[model samples]
Target: MTDSPVLRLDGVAFTYAGGAGVSGLDVSIAPGEAVALIGPNGAGKSTLLKGVLGLVPQTAGHMSFADADAAAAQRPVHAPDGMVGFLPQSAELDADFPINLEQVVMQGRYRSLGLFRWPGRADRAAVRDAIETVGLGALVKRRFGELSGGQRQRGLLARALASEPRLLLLDEPFNGLDQANRDALIDTIRRLKQRGVSVLVSTHDLELARLVCDTVVLVNGTQLASGPVDEVLTLGNVQECFEGVEVEIDEHTLVVPGHEGH
Candidate 1:
């Protein structure tokens, strides 16, 4: 509930050199709000994330984070104190990479610890605290690849949490998770919001979006409809952006085509 904005995209536009797709993406996210970006395949959900991160160059408009313009030296975007933590859809880790879970979480702390500074007792304690927050205390010594899909996701989230970011960005986090894992992660996100972390999750799961999102960002890359969940996730809006989609909401209960077949 802070008056200042943590992330802001003003009249942003990104177009591929070959004219492949995506343009005119304008959005804003405030502090302590949980927002979900929903759309179909090739809808530029990933592209938008890339744009905010400044991974892809924008042809027009501007992006500023924490009131700081995305700096040129950083390429895509830069926030001081590692103002943001991002978890990609596909986390690259070697099965026999030989990195333990504790070490993995410590990676986030590297930003605060200068390149020459080694991770000391303080860093180790912070990593332990982050691991416990994700409910992975028992598996601290386990190899990252050794955990199940859900646990692995949690571990990845723990890594993100280690950075102590005010704004968190995620791309397709629910890709390989099951019911139990999805529920657990969703709850974890809610907790983060409660603690005043701004969250932006890109997902294809309508039910999950409707459940965890306070704001829904309906994106089609070149197009975007963003607002409160009920206003943006309406039947007409969903069909218009998602195509061939049906949504029925009765008494705050949304009947989506995939989850309940409502």
Candidate 2:
């Protein structure tokens, strides 16, 4: 993979019309690098992801993808078509929906195919590959509601992968996963990195960040600190981001006071 950054944001600010959001942010994700976004509730973590996806408007700053210059003017609302994939916190799929796993993954191709067009041979192949990439090939025909929580998450991940995006954005991807599923998800993320896909994930789990990310960005409505994981995830930075909350640091382990029993 090239050494160029897949995502670049300079002094970016996004806000819902008259609503709270993030601002004055500068961040970059290089090809194959994974960056973890950490913060307390209402810290704009989800807003940042929404801004990148064009679900929210960017009120200020410059954002660009790869060689695409002046993207703020050319493509201000969102990442370029097919350049980014997003996995939201909630899939919002009805467990009773009749759609199968492969059908769900094929939805990722909708942007490229348009509403009138159908999946072609290449699109089908992409769906197959994406499912296999997440180790869900055997469950391709399973109903969406039948899979466990972790399995559903993997299925969503496969849907994201089917887009063949250079950058992937995940918001609280590990929230409901059990240990086995979490381990599998981590392995999947590792494979994505090896394949040169840059990743930006927002999560509360510091251990998860330490395990899968190369960098960490601590945010509280705005970027507090961002750098190599070891530097950015220090006791001081984390506690500062989580203001008023009790945090304990022991070697490489960090425990938030009330969350320790969880």
The Cα error of candidate 2 at residue 172, in Å, is 0.2
Instruction: Compute the lDDT of residue 249 as modeled in candidate 1.
Output: 39
CA shift at 37, candidate 1, in angstroms? 0.6
Q: Show pairs that collide, candidate 1.
A: 54-76
User: Which runs of model 1 end up more than 4 angstroms from their true locations?
Assistant: 69-77, 245-262
Q: Model 2: what TM-score?
A: 0.91
Task: Give one digit per residue, the lDDT tens place, for model 2 in 1-262.
Answer: 6677898888898899987999878899999999998898899999999998888898888887787767344456456889999999997889799999999999999989997987999999999999998889999999988999899999999999999999999999988789888888888889999999999999888887878899998888889999998888776677678766643333244554342332
Tell me the tens digit of each residue's lDDT in model 1 across 12-52.
Answer: 76666776556666677888888888887888888777766
Question: Model 1, 141: alpha-carbon shift in Å?
Answer: 1.3
RMSD of 2: 3.8
Error of 1 at 261 (Å): 27
Per-residue lDDT for 188 in model 2?
86
RMSD to the true structure for each prediction, in A, is 4.7, 3.8
- lDDT at residue 157 of model 1 (Cα atoms): 89
